[model samples]
Target: MEPREFFIEDRLERFRLKAFCNLGESGLGFFRLEEVLGMAGISVSDLLDLPMNDAPNQGSLELRSAIAKLYPGVSPEQVLVTTGTGEALYLAFHMMVKPKTKVALIWPAFQALYEIPKMLGAEIIPVPQEKAFLASTWKEIDANLYILNHPHNPTGKTFPDAEWENLLSWFREKKKLVLFDEHYRFLPGEGSLGKTGVDPNHSFFGTGSFTKCFGVTGLRVGWLVAEESFVQRARSFKDYLTHTVSPISEKIALGLLENKESFLPGIQTRVRNNIAKFTSLWRKLPHTKDFTVPQGGLVGWLMLEPGISSEAYADRLFEKTGVFVLPGSNFEEEGFLRIGFGETEERMAEGLKRWSECTDLI
Candidate 1:
């Protein structure tokens, strides 16, 4: 069956290649192969000797084991490593959603979270960020599944642990499945929400990747954690899709995971610095109406003046300046812009300066 156009990705496909300052990109700047190898304590000789075959259908045992260690009490048997979080989300949606299923989707999320279910004929109920954090709101809706992004995309809002616990309990009591995208959950001091163990009852499925947190988007390493039976079912379904991740990617991801301590500090420092620079610059700009300082992740949700449409603003900015920031329309909303600060400090500063110049023209 044919799926509808994926708006955000399609938009990116058109301009991403030529954009001088890609403020729409969601991940931190990439890590070079030499740097990654150095952090992992692996030499070029080790990579040269790695097997060229596809990894196990689920994932290489060592890779899966390393992923499992991120979550307390989780075993490799409960993990299914896929090409990236994109594939993991696809698998989860296919396994859990069906025609007429009622899904509560957290809004302003990555398009895939809601769009795939909509394609499957599931009845979707949009839950705004404000309502999602409150237990009172969940009481009003009857849903079979709840799809959410923690350290949410675009907004970067994260609920407190108590709220999450309450929400999870409510889902458990209602027998609703929870598919949490924790791709941007990693930050300084605080670890990912996915680090919480998957329950044996199969109530929660956490999907994440190395792309956002560790700046290894090229590796395309992502995984899902759930009950063993759930993982088995998802793994079986995976065979018909991409089947298995490339062995080379799996080996590299394994090294990254094994040496996370060596790499994370520097990555975290860069991200924190960029965020500070973006926030400070944005607050002083004339066009800046309001914005949320992202608690985690690379993007900041920015509201422009009431009369300004984010789409038009972004387009004009791209034409006048070479910088790009995603319009809220890309996320099926309007009136806001998603400003990403994932680039280096210098690049981010230059992009913001260009944006300021574009605003002057407006």
Candidate 2:
């Protein structure tokens, strides 16, 4: 069957505060906005009173500069803001992938990569994972258009620079467009969409979001980086789609960007602590499930014992534990379950205990 993004809604709701790590959701995690606000001290009175009729210039300008600072060498012109990474992706696919266009997507990726293009009627060639895990090597897809995941979902595998370079060259040689998802770009030293000043004619586009990295899911903000021409086309589509982002949210996000250095380090510490806990727990357990310890992102996948289908196991676990999690079936694979430790420390500890009770000790 032509594959699609794994459906995870049922699993999470069914499970009792599931240990689901499939999607990049940081459960019950909140930005320390209060602390940040105190520092900004930019009171309601501080808002540069301007018309919200169009995208608020008050927030967007500085926000762009902030992004430029984080991702050095990338100009603000390359960064096109949208309501969320989802919107950025929707617009990119809508504008770029036509009915006859050939598309390649990484397996175990977010549901949208392949599903969106297919929905747009593009010819899809999915690079499904080899049996053991969700994210596989580049060899899986013979053709070139690469929909990639650095710190990929479900598996939490961060492709190394060497691999990224190889893939970049391959795409360039084959003259294929790349749609890279840097939703988890907060990972230190994560790969970029292209080499410095890489030509957009060969390298197509990228979508990055603050939601996954900054715990700002409510902000629903993301951006697209490509050649200026590509940005122009996407902007045209976006103008028709949502027009622009919320003026107020853009302001808050702008403030956060202004002080990311102080903020992100703390968030990273929280993520690292939770991951450390999960790593320690997994080491003791004998589920025989193995996966990469993510370098930066917030999710991972576990392969179940042979002959025990991930679907059946995940279903049974949810039935008994009320701890919901995404199964490998959701990623169109078998013998695996996605486990997220991106939740709060309490939830992480409690979820681990529940998981041991349900899986290993039982």
Candidate 3:
């Protein structure tokens, strides 16, 4: 099958080699093993005692139990741990999406959300962020699965509570599957973490990872929350992939979840401060317009001055300043850019400075 190119990951892979100031990532800053263990209060002895073996295919009970605690009414059996949220998305789309199946997807999303299903020969109906939660979008589109990225990626705009209530009611009436990519749901905002009690129905399929909220990307630990039967099916499908995460990673993930209360507040504060820092600088650029204030998530969006190609400008920025940012074209929305501020304040300041310098030169 000739699949569509995954532009975001492709550009990121190339950026890894020469990026001096990275502003393209969409998650929290990476944490060192020592820092994570320190925050989680895990000791060297605790890690040493872990066996160097594969964890349970569906994840350890201890880890799943910790994850379940985040979502009220969810039990360990309803969670299927995977390498990361990326894999969890793959498992669900693979299982549910098929030829001719229509998927209603939120636009300007992480490419994988739609790309995976498209690869499975599914038909995609894009729902623009401006009207994503509109009753018309839900009622008008007869889709097999609806995908929503809470506090959506790139733009970070969230729907209103009333819209959410309306959508839930629609789901109850339609009984169609809805995939909630809540990777950034834990972000601090007026309604952040308010989704404590998920809809107790077979219609909801949720995927998230520790990378964004916990800043433990190296662990590659994430999970899928669905009905017990669907989770079991996903676990079986995982055997064809990585099968299971390493026990060491699972142990560390468990520690992170168990002690999330200690670190999450700090993460929220850092993200808010970084967004402030970034906006203060970004607004000064002559070429930026239509700037969207991010409600939550690590990244935000601003349109490039019309007539200037976002991809061309981004390439030029990297060339002139050694700073990297994602072009909006990667998200299928041109004339904009996604700037990440989820780094140390010092690094973010320097990156923004370099980015600003490039704007003047361009």
Q: Which has the greatest TM-score?
A: 3
User: Which residue segments of model 2 deviate by more than 4 Å?
Assistant: 1-6, 9-28, 32-51, 56-59, 128-144, 189-204, 283-288, 309-312, 315-322, 359-362
Tell me the tens digit of each residue's lDDT in model 3 across 279-320: 777776658877777887778888888787889888888888
Q: Best to worst by lDDT, what's the order?
A: 3, 1, 2
Choose the strongest candidate by lDDT: 3
The worst-scoring run of ten residues by lDDT in candidate 3 lies at 191-200
Q: Using TM-score as the measure, name the better of candidate 1 and candidate 2.
A: 1
Better of 1 and 3 by lDDT: 3
Decreasing TM-score order of the candidates:
3, 1, 2
Write down the lDDT of every candidate, Cα atoms only. Answer: 0.79, 0.63, 0.81
| lDDT per residue as tens, model 2, 30-98 | 456564454344466556674566773222667766655555456677778888877888888877777
Q: What are the models' TM-scores?
A: 0.94, 0.81, 0.95
Report the C-alpha lDDT of model 1 over 280-325, residue by residue, as the tens digit. 8786654658887877777779887777777887887888888888
Off by over 4 Å in 1: 188-202
